[model samples]
Target: MKLDRTAIEALLPHRAPILLPTEVEADPATRSGRALIRLDANARIFGALAQPALAHELLLEAAAQTFGIVIGACPPEGGAAAGAEGRHLLLGFDEVEFGPAALDGGAPFELEVALEQTSGPVHVARFSAEQGGAQVARGQLQVFNG
Candidate 1:
């Protein structure tokens, strides 16, 4: 069965994480689907201004547990949504840490996080945060499906 945006959203447990549609236009010349997603690392939407630690929580090693949210987007038409059904494997945070926030800066701080496909019981991925091209914090998370 194919999954649409609504169905996918329902399956996802993360309530407020930012979600960006991963879509590509079909090529008229070759008539290819062009559905494969080429995500620009800079396009990710950070947590809202309402919550201060929300964004930081995503970068923490324990973030997957601290806050719930899905990490990646399925194909344009939609593929098997990535997430768990009930619980996830925990990747405790130890060395990851975010720098202090600036009062005048637009973004509290910029972060670079990555999620990799895993075959474990939990949804696992790698994450990092940086400022002025300097690595400020980094960690891994295991998002629960339920």
Candidate 2:
């Protein structure tokens, strides 16, 4: 399924500034997804730090939101409205690597996320981000759904 900003807003709890991706494509059956984020000077991250590079925390949040979209699109059996009523928590991160900084120049970036495993309300996903054909970051996110 393809999700726009409105759909993303409906699915995610995050609002403007914090909300990252402009669009997303998710395959619920395969539990895989991709998202596109365009960062510009107006982005909150830029305003907060006034740095030329996108912060690592923002990248991580973007990955998390992308995964959230995937899960939101595919609600489990008897699960509530995806993330509507559920609480998604970041359990931890594994083997996270931050590559070259992403400059705030209205450049677009892509994020890919794949489900690694699921145990109860906990879901593990591998994610990576790329900008200008170069890797920006990668990590495994352990998320808990409740």
Candidate 3:
């Protein structure tokens, strides 16, 4: 299920997308997605995603997971028609991190991501996951015209 540039563009809002390198870490659960890494002004890189650690064959997997998602043509305005103004496009992984066992007490873990339109000018967007009243994880992805 490798999506080429055309397929990705058709599925996303922006004509082009900034596909970062695929990163994966060992987890007890089988959930899978990419890890977002960021660097500060002092040139220190930080992991935006969080994963639980276990003692096993420590290894990092490098591949796109089955959890990535892309949504185009967002819902319309409040109680309005389908073809309303200001549509939204979203792209990110649904579940990221995996192994043979579930995360802490069978609860799903969340990862953070950042997206941007970075060709000439860099415009950014951020996303976070929440359940009930607690925050879970976050992610980001970039889109552009083809």
Candidate 4:
């Protein structure tokens, strides 16, 4: 399924400037997904910096959001939405590798995430970010579902 900004906003708690994904593509069955984020001046991380670039933290957030899209798409076993009540928390990052910064040129990037494992409320996913078909970052995110 393809989700626009409004639909994405409805599924996620993040608001604009921080809600990075412009669009999301997800498979509820496989629990894998990809999200597109177009970096512009409006991105909060840019602030007032003359030359803005995609920070590692922001990339991580994007990855987490992408994962959130997947989780939100596939509700829990009982049909309860994941993070519907803002209970999901990013527990940590593992083996995170940062690449070249995405400058403020209205360039679009893609974040892809796949479910790696789940231990109770802790969900682990592997994620990667790419721009112009080149990898910009990769990491594993651990999210705690409440």
Cα error, residue 136 of model 1, in Å, equals: 1.8
lDDT of 2 by residue, 1-146 (tens): 89998898887755566788889999867778999976553256534643255456677878988888888787555654554537677788899998866544467779999998988889999999988888988999999987
Candidate 1: clashing residue pairs, number: 2
Residue by residue across 1-146, what tens digits does model 4's lDDT show?
A: 88888888887765555888889998776778999876563356546522254466677878988888778876665667654534578888999987765543367788899988888888899999988888888989999987
Candidate 2: where is the Cα deviation over 4 Å? 45-54, 77-85, 101-105
lDDT of 1 by residue, 12-108 (tens): 3353243321222222222122111111321244522422334344334223322222332332123343432344445454455555643222333
TM-score for all predictions?
0.39, 0.83, 0.23, 0.83
- Candidate closest to the true structure, highest lDDT: 2
Q: Which portions of model 1 miss their true places by more than 4 Å?
A: 1-72, 75-94, 99-105
lDDT string for model 3 (1-146, tens) is 23343443344323222332222222212212233311111111133223234211011110121122221222222444322433332232333333443334223223332332334322233444322234443444333222
Q: Tell me model 3's lDDT, rounded to 2 decimals.
A: 0.28
lDDT of 2 at 22: 87
Span of 10 residues, lowest total lDDT, candidate 4? 45-54
Per-residue error (Å), model 4, residue 126: 0.4
Worst 10 residues of 1 by lDDT: 30-39
Q: What is the lDDT of residue 21 in candidate 3?
A: 20
